[model samples]
Target: MTYIAEQERYDKMTYNRSGKSGLRLPAISLGLWHNFGGINVLENQRAMARRAFDLGITHFDLANNYGPPPGSAEENFGTLLKQDLAPYRDELIISTKAGYYMWPGPYGEWGSKKNLVASLNQSLTRMGLDYVDIFYHHRPDPNTPLEETMSALDLIVRQGKALYVGLSNYSAEQTREASRILKSLGTPCLIHQPSYSMLNRWIEDGLQDVLDEEGIGSIAFSPLAGGMLTDRYLNGIAPDSRAAGPSVFMKPEQVTEERLAKVRKLDELAKSRGQKMSQLALAWVLRGGRVTSALIGASKVSQIEDAVGALAALEFTGEELALIEGILQG
Candidate 1:
């Protein structure tokens, strides 16, 4: 079957400029950080991608080490591009990252010019694309010189392998320095990707201020705090949940009763607003218009639909905001 995009694809979504960059990304972008791997069903991935695009999601985020085996997410997404999204290529913002352990060699990871260049080249080959809209250095490397990493990103842009370069999981000081280097090289940092949510508000400490000053946009990953902000664990961790599985990120002990109490209060507040806990969390992340986008990972098409539905009611009253703060603090 041929895939035809919805004619009204761009109508329902909000597009925000990436800092000073001319590119505008959907408020809610699909991230292939999980569940789009070789172990997952490709048909479900296709359904989610199709549904996302139909609902006006124009960005698909990926990383070289996203899959369980590493590189399989890009492979699966490449199949999706060939089968469905290839024709609408210009309408999408495809971004990928490198930095984590991808392969077993010294050149396989980190922020070195060799590793960043090689990782992105492999990513392009895996995704079957001439250039990604954004290429991110996945994390700051303490051992590698900052100039070398930023120069590698500048080089990636000059080489035409990536249209723009971004930073992920970098602190405010690191971002300021890298942005300085990239600007000197004539490729200003376009965006920053960070872990932010109502449960995890570390970015508020100082990172957001730096981004604002530097004119760099930001997209929040784990906006749901690995599903904690959602109602999934309000009662308790389900046996089939990621916490119960062998997942390395979130574990059962992390879901303390203290956390569940807060989640329950948040759930009540969400119901008062006629929204799901997840929807409220998404709205909160995109609140104040400070963050450019919220990156969401979906296991099924319905998750994507639910995430899109969050945009329907993005505004929050002062009282609502205060109550949320109280709930988070309590």
Candidate 2:
């Protein structure tokens, strides 16, 4: 049976302007960083993508090295796009990144002109698109010249390969420098994707101020702190959870007794507010004005629905903020 989108999708979520650009992204965007990989069943990936679009998640994030086998996530997403989402292409904000370890040899990774150009071309080919909505430098490469990286981004936009450009995991200082270089080249940086959650407040150090001053937007990844902010760890590690997986991104050691206690306390606070722990965590990230969107990865369609449901009631009072700060600081 052909899937049809929910009619109330647009009415449920709010959109925010991405920096000063004309793009308005849904407050909650879907990311294909995990579970949409090569080893996973393609049918599940297709269903997830369709479900996301049906729920008004217009922005989809991807990277060149998302799959465990490398490059398979994009390949899988491309197949899904062709098979299920081809008609809604214009309505979607599809983004992909380069700069991580994608291929072999000297130019496989990092922020070099050769690397960026080659990686994006391969990404475009894999995704079966003429151009991605946003192309990001996945990370800052210390070995490569910043100007060279910016030049490649400029060329990508000029040649109609990417509609906009972004940077990820860059510090405030690096973002300032890259902004200047991109501005000089006539291709302004559109957004910065950073790993930000209540547990990870590193961006609050200075990145937010830099983005505000530069008029750039920010999309926070891991808004639920890799499911740590959720109630999954309160009792014990679920066998099906990411913590139980072989991935290095989340480990069992990190969920110490102290961490579980904190999560439990936060969970109590969330229940008092009539929301789930994941919803509270997501709402907390969106409270600050600087965050344009929360990039989330889900293994199930129910998770996506739960995450988006928080958007309707996303306000936090000052007292609530103080209690959260106390819990986090404790």
C-alpha displacement of 201 in model 1, angstroms? Answer: 0.4
Winning candidate number (lDDT): 1
Report the poorest 10 consecutive residues by lDDT, candidate 1.
226-235
Clashing pairs in 2: none
Which candidate leads in TM-score? 1
- What tens digits encode model 1's per-residue C-alpha lDDT throughout 1-330? 898989998898999988878889899999999999999999999999999999999999999998866999999999999999999999889999999999888999999999999999999999999999999999999999999999999999999999999999999999999999999999999999999999899999999999999999999999998988887888799988889899886889889998898889989988998999999999999998999999999999988888988999899999999998998899
CA lDDT, every model vs. true structure:
0.94, 0.91
Candidate 1 local distance difference test against the native: 0.94
Please report, as a residue range, the 10-residue window in candidate 2 with the lowest summed lDDT: 1-10
